[model samples]
Target: MAANNLRGQVLSLYSRLLRMSRNWNATNPAETIVERQYIKEETMELFRKNKHHSEPFIIKECLKEAEARMTMAEHYRNPYPRPVNLPKRSFSKKEGKKIGKAIQKFNEQSRPIYIRSTDDAVGRSS
Candidate 1:
């Protein structure tokens, strides 16, 4: 029953993504065609490639990724994927280089730290 629900969710998300791609329009006239094509092609290719997976966890993860991408696209008004790493030019300045080294050290040293509110930590009540 849960599997059937997950399948339905995936199909619904896929349909919405396709509709979004078909209707995509960029603010820049020159980019509308390119961005629209990219959205459509990427959506179709990824959905087709992952259609064989029967695992609910994997499907949920994929759905989460698709939803996040849609939210980001709408928020940023751009459909292109974000870059995983900063461009080399970003580290060309002395300050930038220092910041880059700090980031690298942090990445190598530990897991991300999540800060909680003092009220939560102390279990405070009004």
Candidate 2:
């Protein structure tokens, strides 16, 4: 039956999303749990919202879009939470603005120095 087929497709998509969600991480365990719960709730809600659609063309198109979304999410999802222990900045917003150029200068100091010479060094003595 068409209804049965549609239900199966929706279930399959939902499970795929859950598996995908497992690969995501948040900065901490509590955040991770919250994120996973949000993902599950949003997914179930989307599928439930469309549960009554019976038209063949609509179902087909919806399935195709779902597949595309799954592929994109799998490919482009963040690999992991950025480290939770990065050094916290002590600067206030105003301090940060005041020291912006100093920060830029500090970063630039790390760059490799480059020297340009017009003469071939081997041919001429210093």
In angstroms, the error of model 1 at 87 is 16
Relative to the true structure, candidate 1 has a C-alpha RMSD (angstroms) of 12.6
- The pairs that clash in candidate 2 are none
How does each model score on lDDT? Answer: 0.66, 0.53
Backbone N/Cα/C clashes per model: 0, 0
lDDT of 1 by residue, 1-126 (tens): 999999899889889988898888898989988888888888887777668778887677667667877887888998865434434433333553454666554442232111101113222110
Q: What is the TM-score of each candidate against the true structure?
A: 0.65, 0.48
Q: What is the C-alpha RMSD of each candidate to the true structure, in Å?
A: 12.6, 21.1
Residue 81 local lDDT, model 1: 56
Query: Pick by lDDT: which candidate is best?
Result: 1
For 1-126, candidate 2 gives per-residue lDDT tens digits of 987888788788878877767666655666777677765665565566656777876666556655655564456553222222213443323643555766545433322121101113211110
